[model samples]
Target: MKMAGIETLSWEPLFVMRLDVAYDRAHPVGGENRRGIFPVVGGTFEGPKMRGRVLDGGADWVSWRGDGTMLIDVRTALETDDGALISMQYTGLSTPTSPEAAARFARREPSPYEDLYLHTTPRFETAHAKYEWLNRVIAVSNGMRTDDGPMYHVFAIT
Candidate 1:
Protein backbone atom coordinates (compact mmCIF):
# COMPACT_ATOMS: atom_id res chain seq x y z
CA MET A 1 0.00 0.00 0.00
CA LYS A 2 1.85 3.06 -1.27
CA MET A 3 0.80 6.65 -0.61
CA ALA A 4 1.13 8.28 -4.05
CA GLY A 5 4.14 10.56 -3.66
CA ILE A 6 5.96 8.39 -1.09
CA GLU A 7 8.03 5.41 -2.16
CA THR A 8 7.32 2.04 -0.54
CA LEU A 9 9.35 -1.17 -0.43
CA SER A 10 8.88 -4.86 0.28
CA TRP A 11 9.47 -6.60 3.61
CA GLU A 12 12.88 -5.83 5.05
CA PRO A 13 13.44 -7.31 8.52
CA LEU A 14 14.61 -4.83 11.12
CA PHE A 15 15.10 -5.20 14.86
CA VAL A 16 11.90 -5.44 16.95
CA MET A 17 11.41 -5.30 20.72
CA ARG A 18 9.17 -3.99 23.55
CA LEU A 19 10.90 -1.36 25.62
CA ASP A 20 9.98 -0.02 29.09
CA VAL A 21 10.34 3.76 28.92
CA ALA A 22 11.10 5.22 32.35
CA TYR A 23 8.91 8.19 33.13
CA ASP A 24 10.48 11.62 33.45
CA ARG A 25 8.52 14.81 32.90
CA ALA A 26 11.51 16.40 31.22
CA HIS A 27 12.51 13.16 29.48
CA PRO A 28 11.23 14.05 26.03
CA VAL A 29 12.06 17.71 26.69
CA GLY A 30 13.07 18.43 23.15
CA GLY A 31 10.33 16.20 21.72
CA GLU A 32 10.72 14.85 18.16
CA ASN A 33 13.32 17.41 17.16
CA ARG A 34 15.78 16.05 19.71
CA ARG A 35 17.81 13.38 17.92
CA GLY A 36 18.91 10.38 19.93
CA ILE A 37 19.79 6.74 19.33
CA PHE A 38 19.16 3.51 21.20
CA PRO A 39 20.44 -0.04 20.85
CA VAL A 40 17.66 -2.45 19.77
CA VAL A 41 18.02 -6.10 20.67
CA GLY A 42 15.99 -9.01 19.32
CA GLY A 43 16.96 -11.60 16.74
CA THR A 44 15.66 -14.91 15.33
CA PHE A 45 13.26 -15.42 18.25
CA GLU A 46 11.13 -12.51 17.08
CA GLY A 47 12.43 -12.39 13.54
CA PRO A 48 10.46 -11.59 10.40
CA LYS A 49 7.00 -11.90 11.91
CA MET A 50 4.29 -10.08 13.88
CA ARG A 51 5.64 -9.38 17.39
CA GLY A 52 3.65 -7.69 20.16
CA ARG A 53 3.65 -7.10 23.93
CA VAL A 54 1.48 -5.35 26.52
CA LEU A 55 3.05 -2.54 28.49
CA ASP A 56 2.74 -2.32 32.30
CA GLY A 57 0.36 0.67 32.22
CA GLY A 58 -3.17 0.39 30.85
CA ALA A 59 -4.04 1.14 27.23
CA ASP A 60 -0.42 0.63 26.21
CA TRP A 61 0.98 -2.10 24.03
CA VAL A 62 3.22 -2.44 20.95
CA SER A 63 3.42 -4.74 17.97
CA TRP A 64 5.87 -4.87 15.08
CA ARG A 65 4.83 -6.34 11.74
CA GLY A 66 7.56 -7.48 9.38
CA ASP A 67 6.58 -4.81 6.87
CA GLY A 68 7.96 -1.23 6.99
CA THR A 69 5.24 0.58 8.94
CA MET A 70 5.80 1.28 12.67
CA LEU A 71 2.47 1.72 14.51
CA ILE A 72 2.91 3.84 17.63
CA ASP A 73 0.14 5.13 19.92
CA VAL A 74 1.30 6.96 23.06
CA ARG A 75 -1.60 9.13 24.12
CA THR A 76 -3.36 9.64 27.49
CA ALA A 77 -1.23 7.17 29.49
CA LEU A 78 1.61 9.66 29.63
CA GLU A 79 -0.19 11.69 32.30
CA THR A 80 0.53 9.06 34.96
CA ASP A 81 3.77 8.77 36.90
CA ASP A 82 4.57 5.24 35.74
CA GLY A 83 5.07 4.96 31.98
CA ALA A 84 3.43 4.17 28.69
CA LEU A 85 3.37 0.95 26.64
CA ILE A 86 5.09 0.90 23.24
CA SER A 87 4.07 -1.01 20.09
CA MET A 88 5.67 -1.13 16.64
CA GLN A 89 4.28 -2.17 13.26
CA TYR A 90 6.27 -2.86 10.12
CA THR A 91 4.64 -3.11 6.67
CA GLY A 92 6.75 -4.50 3.84
CA LEU A 93 6.13 -3.08 0.41
CA SER A 94 6.55 -5.27 -2.69
CA THR A 95 7.16 -2.58 -5.33
CA PRO A 96 10.62 -1.32 -4.48
CA THR A 97 12.90 -1.60 -7.52
CA SER A 98 15.93 -2.47 -5.43
CA PRO A 99 15.78 -5.65 -3.37
CA GLU A 100 19.17 -4.95 -1.82
CA ALA A 101 17.88 -1.68 -0.42
CA ALA A 102 15.39 -3.60 1.69
CA ALA A 103 17.96 -6.16 2.78
CA ARG A 104 20.27 -3.47 4.11
CA PHE A 105 17.95 -2.82 7.09
CA ALA A 106 18.06 -6.47 8.21
CA ARG A 107 21.09 -6.38 10.41
CA ARG A 108 22.46 -5.70 13.88
CA GLU A 109 23.03 -2.11 12.89
CA PRO A 110 20.91 -0.72 10.07
CA SER A 111 21.54 2.40 8.09
CA PRO A 112 18.90 5.10 7.84
CA TYR A 113 16.09 4.37 5.42
CA GLU A 114 14.68 7.60 4.01
CA ASP A 115 10.94 8.15 3.62
CA LEU A 116 9.66 10.87 1.30
CA TYR A 117 6.20 12.41 0.93
CA LEU A 118 5.38 11.33 4.46
CA HIS A 119 2.00 12.71 5.48
CA THR A 120 1.32 13.19 9.17
CA THR A 121 -2.14 13.94 10.55
CA PRO A 122 -1.94 15.81 13.78
CA ARG A 123 -3.80 14.36 16.78
CA PHE A 124 -4.95 17.20 18.97
CA GLU A 125 -6.90 16.17 22.06
CA THR A 126 -8.12 19.59 23.14
CA ALA A 127 -9.88 22.36 21.21
CA HIS A 128 -7.44 24.94 22.59
CA ALA A 129 -4.62 23.78 20.33
CA LYS A 130 -4.15 25.93 17.25
CA TYR A 131 -3.36 24.43 13.89
CA GLU A 132 -0.60 25.88 11.77
CA TRP A 133 0.39 25.83 8.11
CA LEU A 134 2.38 22.96 6.73
CA ASN A 135 6.07 23.52 6.20
CA ARG A 136 7.07 23.51 2.55
CA VAL A 137 10.28 21.87 1.54
CA ILE A 138 11.88 22.39 -1.84
CA ALA A 139 12.31 18.66 -2.31
CA VAL A 140 12.63 15.40 -0.43
CA SER A 141 13.68 11.89 -1.31
CA ASN A 142 14.99 13.21 -4.64
CA GLY A 143 11.53 14.36 -5.73
CA MET A 144 9.27 17.40 -5.44
CA ARG A 145 6.93 17.95 -2.43
CA THR A 146 4.18 20.19 -3.89
CA ASP A 147 3.53 19.94 -7.62
CA ASP A 148 1.89 23.41 -7.81
CA GLY A 149 4.19 26.04 -6.32
CA PRO A 150 7.93 25.38 -6.79
CA MET A 151 9.72 22.13 -7.35
CA TYR A 152 11.07 20.56 -4.16
CA HIS A 153 12.81 17.21 -4.15
CA VAL A 154 11.63 14.73 -1.51
CA PHE A 155 12.54 11.05 -1.41
CA ALA A 156 10.95 8.21 0.61
CA ILE A 157 14.37 7.19 1.91
CA THR A 158 13.54 5.41 5.17
Candidate 2:
Protein backbone atom coordinates (compact mmCIF):
# COMPACT_ATOMS: atom_id res chain seq x y z
CA MET A 1 0.00 0.00 0.00
CA LYS A 2 1.71 3.17 -1.18
CA MET A 3 0.60 6.53 0.09
CA ALA A 4 -0.45 9.12 -2.46
CA GLY A 5 2.03 11.86 -3.27
CA ILE A 6 4.61 10.23 -1.07
CA GLU A 7 7.52 8.21 -2.28
CA THR A 8 9.80 6.09 -0.15
CA LEU A 9 13.42 7.03 -0.40
CA SER A 10 16.16 4.46 -0.82
CA TRP A 11 19.86 4.80 -0.15
CA GLU A 12 22.52 3.71 -2.58
CA PRO A 13 25.89 3.18 -1.00
CA LEU A 14 28.34 5.48 -2.75
CA PHE A 15 31.44 5.15 -0.61
CA VAL A 16 32.85 4.76 2.88
CA MET A 17 36.19 5.57 4.44
CA ARG A 18 38.14 7.55 6.95
CA LEU A 19 39.54 10.95 5.93
CA ASP A 20 42.97 11.98 7.21
CA VAL A 21 43.41 15.62 8.14
CA ALA A 22 46.28 17.46 9.77
CA TYR A 23 45.00 19.84 12.38
CA ASP A 24 46.59 23.26 12.20
CA ARG A 25 46.66 25.08 15.49
CA ALA A 26 43.66 27.39 15.92
CA HIS A 27 44.35 31.02 15.12
CA PRO A 28 42.45 34.21 15.63
CA VAL A 29 40.61 34.99 12.45
CA GLY A 30 38.72 37.65 14.41
CA GLY A 31 35.18 38.68 14.98
CA GLU A 32 33.93 36.57 17.95
CA ASN A 33 35.28 33.13 17.25
CA ARG A 34 38.57 31.33 16.71
CA ARG A 35 39.15 30.05 13.19
CA GLY A 36 41.36 27.20 12.04
CA ILE A 37 42.33 25.48 8.83
CA PHE A 38 43.03 21.79 8.88
CA PRO A 39 44.96 20.67 5.87
CA VAL A 40 43.56 17.50 4.34
CA VAL A 41 46.76 15.49 4.10
CA GLY A 42 45.53 12.22 2.56
CA GLY A 43 43.19 9.23 2.95
CA THR A 44 41.37 6.39 1.19
CA PHE A 45 37.79 5.62 0.20
CA GLU A 46 36.10 2.59 -1.36
CA GLY A 47 32.71 1.11 -2.12
CA PRO A 48 30.70 -0.55 -4.89
CA LYS A 49 30.40 2.66 -6.89
CA MET A 50 33.79 4.22 -6.26
CA ARG A 51 37.26 3.67 -4.84
CA GLY A 52 39.85 6.34 -4.49
CA ARG A 53 42.59 7.94 -2.42
CA VAL A 54 42.47 11.49 -1.20
CA LEU A 55 44.84 13.89 -2.86
CA ASP A 56 47.22 16.24 -1.12
CA GLY A 57 46.70 20.02 -0.58
CA GLY A 58 42.96 20.22 0.08
CA ALA A 59 41.84 21.72 3.38
CA ASP A 60 39.00 21.99 5.84
CA TRP A 61 38.25 25.50 7.06
CA VAL A 62 36.68 25.37 10.50
CA SER A 63 35.15 27.95 12.74
CA TRP A 64 34.56 27.42 16.41
CA ARG A 65 31.14 28.58 17.48
CA GLY A 66 30.67 29.67 21.05
CA ASP A 67 28.09 26.92 21.32
CA GLY A 68 28.83 23.24 21.02
CA THR A 69 28.76 23.40 17.21
CA MET A 70 31.84 23.43 15.01
CA LEU A 71 31.03 25.03 11.69
CA ILE A 72 33.03 23.50 8.87
CA ASP A 73 33.80 23.90 5.21
CA VAL A 74 35.50 20.85 3.79
CA ARG A 75 36.99 20.79 0.31
CA THR A 76 38.76 17.74 -0.98
CA ALA A 77 39.48 15.71 -4.09
CA LEU A 78 39.58 12.00 -4.92
CA GLU A 79 41.32 10.23 -7.78
CA THR A 80 39.55 7.03 -8.70
CA ASP A 81 41.34 3.89 -9.69
CA ASP A 82 40.54 4.57 -13.33
CA GLY A 83 41.96 8.10 -12.99
CA ALA A 84 38.89 10.25 -12.71
CA LEU A 85 39.16 13.27 -10.45
CA ILE A 86 36.14 13.96 -8.30
CA SER A 87 35.83 17.15 -6.35
CA MET A 88 33.76 17.10 -3.20
CA GLN A 89 32.68 19.70 -0.69
CA TYR A 90 30.47 19.58 2.38
CA THR A 91 29.49 22.19 4.94
CA GLY A 92 28.00 21.12 8.25
CA LEU A 93 27.90 21.42 11.99
CA SER A 94 29.39 19.15 14.63
CA THR A 95 27.69 19.50 17.98
CA PRO A 96 28.86 17.69 21.09
CA THR A 97 26.55 16.47 23.83
CA SER A 98 28.53 18.21 26.53
CA PRO A 99 31.51 20.43 27.15
CA GLU A 100 33.55 17.39 28.09
CA ALA A 101 32.80 15.70 24.79
CA ALA A 102 33.64 18.89 23.00
CA ALA A 103 36.95 19.03 24.81
CA ARG A 104 37.62 15.45 23.81
CA PHE A 105 37.03 16.35 20.18
CA ALA A 106 39.33 19.34 20.48
CA ARG A 107 42.03 17.20 21.99
CA ARG A 108 41.84 14.78 19.06
CA GLU A 109 40.59 11.93 21.22
CA PRO A 110 38.44 9.02 20.14
CA SER A 111 35.20 10.94 20.16
CA PRO A 112 32.67 8.72 18.47
CA TYR A 113 29.86 9.96 16.28
CA GLU A 114 27.40 8.96 19.01
CA ASP A 115 28.79 11.78 21.09
CA LEU A 116 27.89 14.37 18.50
CA TYR A 117 25.76 15.17 15.50
CA LEU A 118 27.89 15.32 12.36
CA HIS A 119 25.83 15.60 9.23
CA THR A 120 26.44 17.02 5.77
CA THR A 121 25.02 17.15 2.29
CA PRO A 122 27.98 16.41 0.04
CA ARG A 123 28.08 17.77 -3.46
CA PHE A 124 30.25 16.19 -6.11
CA GLU A 125 31.85 17.45 -9.30
CA THR A 126 33.33 15.35 -12.04
CA ALA A 127 33.97 15.65 -15.76
CA HIS A 128 34.58 12.11 -16.99
CA ALA A 129 31.76 10.89 -19.15
CA LYS A 130 31.30 7.57 -17.37
CA TYR A 131 31.30 9.17 -13.93
CA GLU A 132 29.30 12.24 -14.86
CA TRP A 133 26.36 10.84 -12.91
CA LEU A 134 27.95 12.11 -9.71
CA ASN A 135 27.34 15.72 -10.75
CA ARG A 136 23.62 15.13 -11.11
CA VAL A 137 22.90 13.24 -7.92
CA ILE A 138 21.93 14.34 -4.44
CA ALA A 139 23.93 12.76 -1.63
CA VAL A 140 24.39 13.01 2.10
CA SER A 141 27.00 11.74 4.51
CA ASN A 142 26.78 10.83 8.16
CA GLY A 143 30.18 11.06 9.78
CA MET A 144 31.90 9.90 12.94
CA ARG A 145 34.98 11.48 14.45
CA THR A 146 37.91 9.23 15.27
CA ASP A 147 41.33 9.85 16.73
CA ASP A 148 42.70 10.72 13.35
CA GLY A 149 39.79 12.39 11.64
CA PRO A 150 36.25 11.78 10.47
CA MET A 151 34.81 8.72 8.75
CA TYR A 152 31.74 9.09 6.61
CA HIS A 153 29.19 6.72 5.19
CA VAL A 154 28.09 8.27 1.94
CA PHE A 155 24.68 7.56 0.50
CA ALA A 156 22.97 8.69 -2.66
CA ILE A 157 19.23 9.29 -2.77
CA THR A 158 17.50 7.03 -5.22
Candidate 3:
Protein backbone atom coordinates (compact mmCIF):
# COMPACT_ATOMS: atom_id res chain seq x y z
CA MET A 1 0.00 0.00 0.00
CA LYS A 2 1.12 3.55 -0.76
CA MET A 3 0.61 6.46 1.57
CA ALA A 4 -1.19 9.57 0.40
CA GLY A 5 0.88 12.73 -0.09
CA ILE A 6 0.59 15.63 2.34
CA GLU A 7 -0.84 17.89 -0.36
CA THR A 8 -4.02 15.79 -0.45
CA LEU A 9 -5.01 16.91 3.05
CA SER A 10 -6.86 20.09 3.81
CA TRP A 11 -8.33 21.90 6.77
CA GLU A 12 -11.84 23.16 7.23
CA PRO A 13 -12.66 25.82 9.81
CA LEU A 14 -14.43 24.07 12.65
CA PHE A 15 -15.08 26.74 15.21
CA VAL A 16 -13.38 29.44 17.20
CA MET A 17 -13.65 29.05 20.95
CA ARG A 18 -12.59 32.08 22.93
CA LEU A 19 -12.27 30.41 26.28
CA ASP A 20 -12.13 32.51 29.41
CA VAL A 21 -9.96 30.86 32.02
CA ALA A 22 -8.14 32.06 35.13
CA TYR A 23 -5.07 30.58 36.72
CA ASP A 24 -5.78 28.85 40.04
CA ARG A 25 -2.13 28.44 41.13
CA ALA A 26 1.06 26.51 40.49
CA HIS A 27 3.05 24.14 42.70
CA PRO A 28 5.87 21.66 42.49
CA VAL A 29 4.80 18.10 41.96
CA GLY A 30 6.67 14.78 42.31
CA GLY A 31 9.83 16.77 43.07
CA GLU A 32 10.42 17.52 39.41
CA ASN A 33 7.20 18.45 37.64
CA ARG A 34 5.31 21.70 38.03
CA ARG A 35 1.55 21.53 37.92
CA GLY A 36 -1.20 24.13 37.87
CA ILE A 37 -4.93 24.43 37.42
CA PHE A 38 -6.73 27.04 35.40
CA PRO A 39 -10.47 27.23 35.80
CA VAL A 40 -12.66 27.72 32.76
CA VAL A 41 -14.84 30.59 33.74
CA GLY A 42 -16.93 31.27 30.60
CA GLY A 43 -16.80 32.29 26.98
CA THR A 44 -18.32 31.67 23.53
CA PHE A 45 -17.68 29.99 20.17
CA GLU A 46 -18.76 30.44 16.56
CA GLY A 47 -18.17 28.96 13.15
CA PRO A 48 -19.87 27.98 9.93
CA LYS A 49 -21.61 24.93 11.38
CA MET A 50 -22.12 25.49 15.07
CA ARG A 51 -22.19 28.31 17.61
CA GLY A 52 -22.19 28.01 21.36
CA ARG A 53 -21.07 29.27 24.74
CA VAL A 54 -18.44 27.65 26.90
CA LEU A 55 -19.59 26.81 30.38
CA ASP A 56 -17.74 27.31 33.63
CA GLY A 57 -16.29 24.68 36.02
CA GLY A 58 -14.08 23.04 33.43
CA ALA A 59 -10.36 23.22 34.20
CA ASP A 60 -7.10 23.23 32.32
CA TRP A 61 -4.68 20.75 33.89
CA VAL A 62 -1.27 22.28 33.21
CA SER A 63 2.20 20.83 33.47
CA TRP A 64 5.42 22.81 33.37
CA ARG A 65 8.21 21.00 31.58
CA GLY A 66 11.99 21.20 32.04
CA ASP A 67 12.65 23.12 28.83
CA GLY A 68 10.53 26.07 30.01
CA THR A 69 7.72 24.98 27.70
CA MET A 70 4.21 24.64 29.08
CA LEU A 71 2.02 21.67 28.23
CA ILE A 72 -1.64 22.56 27.98
CA ASP A 73 -4.37 20.09 28.78
CA VAL A 74 -7.90 21.35 28.95
CA ARG A 75 -11.41 19.93 29.11
CA THR A 76 -14.31 22.15 28.16
CA ALA A 77 -18.06 21.81 27.79
CA LEU A 78 -19.97 23.80 25.21
CA GLU A 79 -23.69 24.56 25.16
CA THR A 80 -24.92 25.33 21.73
CA ASP A 81 -27.45 28.08 21.36
CA ASP A 82 -29.78 25.40 20.04
CA GLY A 83 -29.31 23.39 23.29
CA ALA A 84 -26.80 20.74 22.26
CA LEU A 85 -23.80 19.76 24.37
CA ILE A 86 -20.29 19.38 23.02
CA SER A 87 -17.19 18.21 24.82
CA MET A 88 -13.89 19.76 23.86
CA GLN A 89 -10.33 18.77 24.72
CA TYR A 90 -7.03 20.12 23.52
CA THR A 91 -3.32 19.56 24.21
CA GLY A 92 -0.41 21.68 23.08
CA LEU A 93 2.74 23.55 23.96
CA SER A 94 3.73 27.12 24.67
CA THR A 95 7.46 27.50 24.40
CA PRO A 96 8.97 30.93 24.88
CA THR A 97 11.69 32.19 22.61
CA SER A 98 13.93 33.49 25.39
CA PRO A 99 14.38 33.38 29.15
CA GLU A 100 12.92 36.86 29.56
CA ALA A 101 10.00 35.87 27.41
CA ALA A 102 9.51 32.77 29.48
CA ALA A 103 9.60 34.84 32.66
CA ARG A 104 6.98 37.19 31.30
CA PHE A 105 4.78 34.27 30.30
CA ALA A 106 5.13 32.62 33.68
CA ARG A 107 4.15 35.84 35.42
CA ARG A 108 0.98 36.12 33.33
CA GLU A 109 2.33 39.24 31.72
CA PRO A 110 1.64 40.45 28.18
CA SER A 111 3.47 38.40 25.58
CA PRO A 112 3.18 38.05 21.82
CA TYR A 113 1.82 34.89 20.22
CA GLU A 114 4.59 35.04 17.66
CA ASP A 115 7.20 35.19 20.41
CA LEU A 116 5.81 32.12 22.12
CA TYR A 117 4.83 29.36 19.77
CA LEU A 118 1.43 28.55 21.30
CA HIS A 119 -0.53 25.84 19.53
CA THR A 120 -2.88 22.96 20.30
CA THR A 121 -4.66 20.11 18.57
CA PRO A 122 -8.31 20.06 19.57
CA ARG A 123 -10.64 17.08 19.67
CA PHE A 124 -14.38 17.35 20.00
CA GLU A 125 -17.33 15.14 20.92
CA THR A 126 -21.04 15.79 20.83
CA ALA A 127 -24.22 13.81 21.03
CA HIS A 128 -26.49 16.26 19.30
CA ALA A 129 -28.04 14.81 16.19
CA LYS A 130 -27.45 17.91 14.11
CA TYR A 131 -23.83 18.42 15.15
CA GLU A 132 -22.76 14.82 15.38
CA TRP A 133 -20.13 15.41 12.75
CA LEU A 134 -17.79 16.78 15.41
CA ASN A 135 -17.43 13.37 16.97
CA ARG A 136 -16.18 11.88 13.73
CA VAL A 137 -13.47 14.24 12.56
CA ILE A 138 -10.10 15.44 13.88
CA ALA A 139 -9.34 19.07 14.59
CA VAL A 140 -6.25 21.25 14.74
CA SER A 141 -6.19 24.41 16.84
CA ASN A 142 -4.02 27.53 16.96
CA GLY A 143 -4.39 30.71 18.94
CA MET A 144 -2.94 33.31 21.23
CA ARG A 145 -3.18 34.41 24.83
CA THR A 146 -5.42 37.31 25.64
CA ASP A 147 -5.36 39.48 28.74
CA ASP A 148 -8.57 37.80 29.78
CA GLY A 149 -7.66 34.23 28.73
CA PRO A 150 -6.50 31.94 25.96
CA MET A 151 -8.37 31.99 22.67
CA TYR A 152 -8.39 29.20 20.09
CA HIS A 153 -9.54 28.71 16.50
CA VAL A 154 -10.06 25.04 15.72
CA PHE A 155 -10.15 23.58 12.24
CA ALA A 156 -11.29 20.17 11.27
CA ILE A 157 -8.97 18.05 9.14
CA THR A 158 -10.71 17.17 5.94
Best-fitting candidate, scored by TM-score: 2
How many clashing residue pairs appear in each of the predictions shown? 37, 0, 0
Q: Write the per-residue lDDT of candidate 2 for residues 1-158, one digit (tens) a residue.
A: 89999989898989996888876543446566677777888898899978989898787887878775888788999999899999999888788887788788767788777877888888999998878999988988888887667898889988
- Per-model TM values vs. the true structure: 0.22, 0.89, 0.86
Against the reference, the lDDT scores of all candidates come to: 0.25, 0.83, 0.81
Off by over 4 Å in 1: 1-97, 113-122, 126-158
Q: What TM-score would candidate 1 get against the native?
A: 0.22
Ten contiguous residues minimizing lDDT sum, candidate 3: 23-32
Q: How much is the lDDT of residue 147 in candidate 1?
A: 19
Q: In terms of lDDT, which candidate is strongest?
A: 2
> TM-score for model 3?
0.86
Of 2 and 3, which scores higher on TM-score? 2
lDDT of prediction 1: 0.25
Error (Å) of candidate 2 at residue 155 is: 0.9
Segments of candidate 3 deviating more than 4 angstroms: 1-7, 24-31
Rate residue 36 of model 2 by lDDT.
Answer: 74
